[model samples]
Target: MQDKKLSELAATIADPARHDPGDAPISISAGLADWMLAQKLSLAFTSYQTGQLIVAGVGPDLRLSFNQQQYARATGLCYDRGRLIVASMFQIWRLENMLRPGHYANNAFDMALVPRTAHTVGYLDTHELSVDTAGQIIFVNSRYSCLATIDDVHSFRPVWQPKFISALAPEDRCHLNGLAMDGGRPRFVTLAGISDEKDGWRAIRQRGGAVIDVASDEVVVSGLTMPHSPRVHDGALWLLDSGRGQIVRVDPANGKQDDVAFCPGFLRGLAFHGNWAIVTVSLAREDKFRELAIQEGLEERGLAAKCGVLIIDTRTGNVDHSILLGGKFTEMFDVALLPGVRNPMTIGPATVDMIGAVTIGNPAP
Candidate 1:
């Protein structure tokens, strides 16, 4: 109905462990090389239950009715020439039947095609997708401890292989998730239950979550609780701190962090349209944090909560709009606004293919 007054929300960092984890050097492992290669996992964006519709939080009264049968669970979303191109955690798919004009069909699955990778190399399940200068698509393969880009959509092959941060160590390993393109360069943040060093120095640095700039290869922000996906919005870097159920905006020039919004439940995905920021929210499950709680066992306890997308206006710091989906049947991985091309999607090869077009860039700004 209206934006939550900032005064009503207490801006307090209750968990000290989540504040900072000084520069504690981690040890390198002997098996970093092999560990990096063996990092793939079963990733589904989970868009279905009964009816084939993948529900999305678009506006206060508007919910995107998509054909789930046409896609897996999409984790990241972006636009390619007005058409909605979603990153289904494990693969990429185009929405054919659901992208229609004013058509709300509560239906279920459609056929999908897995893009063929280079040399028959298996597709290294990836999360987010960002376009590069020549239309090359940059993606994060959660399984493989590295970042890669494919020049063509039809031929899923990586043209560039950036050196991984783990490669620096005898055995380096890190969970590369939530990638954002900063100033046209690949910058990423990481999330790990363990350490990335190979020398058995599992420095437990994460109180909540952390992110990094891949190009600079530096950990710009740290001490967060389960911060998964991040984006640069309104000239500032914004991220979803899932553990705390809040959205944070950090200014790169001076490292000034501001709390823009919060979702008490499971808030993961984040995106922006004009001056408004959209976050995918889900109900929080305390059982998932059992091991971490026992390990650190901090005195100040954080509350476990529910899930939904919370939209906020950066200019006025007001939530002028929002879309609340029923938690029982609604679990969204990512959200994207389709521009020009109406639904009923299909993907083959972009005329100005994003996979190789170096001119294309990130959605952040």
Candidate 2:
């Protein structure tokens, strides 16, 4: 994460059919508008590189509407029960939708996520997070190489860690980056390496990536390249083999990874909307991602790497739509889906009346 001029950074992001994106260009693929309209859903994503929480949805005119909210290094997003859990630089913010079923904001949006609570946890380089069936937030504490939850009297409560990790130290020994929940429980996790020392993943980040079972601490699959985003979709385990620019399904029993789709950039965050798998893609960072298979794969197809989101049809491995970023933002961390929500917006910490807009509990008769 070295400092670079915008001009120099722009060289990495691809110019895929620019669409006058604010502070950048967004290339929307054909039929994406129609597909979004039919699905009745919206997207919420984050970019720690640019420190923003962005929401994208189809408008009534069949075009896309993007709303970006400011946050300090926003990394992970979790949308459940009409609430969004946003992980940022220093704290985890819990936001709730204020609009009711028939209500719309500004005569267009049906959902507005307003920050309701903030848990100060310092900076543990937290990555992906999710809420279980019982409404508890579980997140990957990458810097500490463990899974943790918010504490009432302390910074965080360590819940689990890789068995290979001898101690719960803030060493980032394995770059654990993803947590996948099954049946509302943390079932699988992704790590860049299996090292047990300080920042040890850097040495093997290229080929030592692995997915581990949360319950058994057994390695489900290994020998990957910067693997990330373990997700449970359609009763299957899917993840991003980032260095190879591929989305793959893992066979837990045989330790096999089956390629589901090949994206054009370094894939990171992944979420599914019905049958479509939505993934975040970014150009390879030289120091960390030099010589990755993704660069060659994209070059072979006459494609350049991009920083944005891709909507892929998992059934056929075809990209249904793409939203490429070209300005200050060069990487995205995570994304989440908002079912039955269109044109989602957000209220920031300084916004007037954002704190006043509250939903009270029902009164007993």
Candidate 3:
């Protein structure tokens, strides 16, 4: 059986010895290792529930290599060139891959991401992030309902906000969460509501979700179900309707949306790797939340909500691989795919190795 094969592979490929005893048990698809190897891809994800940033990749023996570092309320993650940027509780960390090509650490890891600098962005509840052509970091400031950039003296510099928002405040009116970049500039954003009042998005959390065009300040798409992670991929717009547990593509012209693939769990993070769309799936929160349509879909399908990574082929809507997480880890916020990076590791601030290793300039290129 397919399920049996996946579990068997997880028994061998998960490398339980490397994981902490208190950490969650991970189950990965049997073909995921081979598939990632073929594509030369690795995965980086954040678990807000567990406060950790994890990197998953393949090694020379073609086995899965999992490394993790603790970051308070780790959420949004991005990998640009040789730099890995991640959003945490009160700081945005810019990590650089320390190894050059043909270099390995301990004759194993090909890439070593070390924290080089951090931007104190306050408790703004930052979400998705992207680097523009000008090499500037643009992040979703959810609490302020705007896209913001890091500031030297201020908490964050507001770059853009929805037209409906009258002013920037910490009221979390629209709950702006996703940022879509096009031509190296932020082009679209996904929000839970178009409300301008304090916590107004909670009144219409189910069907009030919408997508706004950054340049034109127009609501290009509306009537979505808790939409998250708006993405520009292959000349098309893709996003997750989290309440419905489905990935939808928007036409942008008439606000028409077509279903692509429906995966278990409430979808959040999305990253494109060649023709494959890597997504983060999470179990819906029980407290301070209403029952969503995703629960009904899962019930009808006799499937439980999953917390892990999913790979969907954009062209045919086929779910190629899935990694499920259980135990202490039950939710994930975002994922970043490291292209051509194998057996990657991240150095946390508490680690002695980070204190010992010193490097100037860029780390990985």
lDDT of 3 by residue, 17-98 (tens): 3333275689989889999888887899998777789999887788888988877678899899988999987789999988
Which portions of model 3 miss their true places by more than 4 Å? 1-21, 287-290, 360-365
Q: State candidate 1's TM-score.
A: 0.59
Candidate 2 C-alpha lDDT tens digits along 1-365:
22353333343233312312357677778787777778988888987777778999877676899888766668888988899999987689999888877988888888888898999887788899998888889999998999999998888999899988999887889999999999999999999999999999989887899999999999888889999999878767889999899999876657667898988888889998778899999866664445677777877898877889999988899988888888766888898889888788888775576757667656889
Off by over 4 Å in 1: 1-67, 94-123, 151-173, 197-205, 289-304, 315-318, 327-330, 340-365
Count of clashes, each model: 51, 0, 0
Instruction: Give the distance in Å from residue 319's predicted Cα in candidate 3 to where it truly belongs.
Output: 2.0
Q: What digit string (tens of lDDT, one per residue) describes model 1 on residues 136-254?
A: 66766554545666534342544222343434222324455567776665666555423554422124523635677666656677877666677876678888766555678899888
Model 3 poorest 10 in a row by lDDT:
12-21
Clashing pairs in 2: none
Q: Which is the winner by TM-score between candidate 2 and candidate 3?
A: 3
lDDT values, one for every candidate: 0.46, 0.84, 0.86
Question: What ranking emerges by lDDT with the best candidate at the front?
Answer: 3, 2, 1
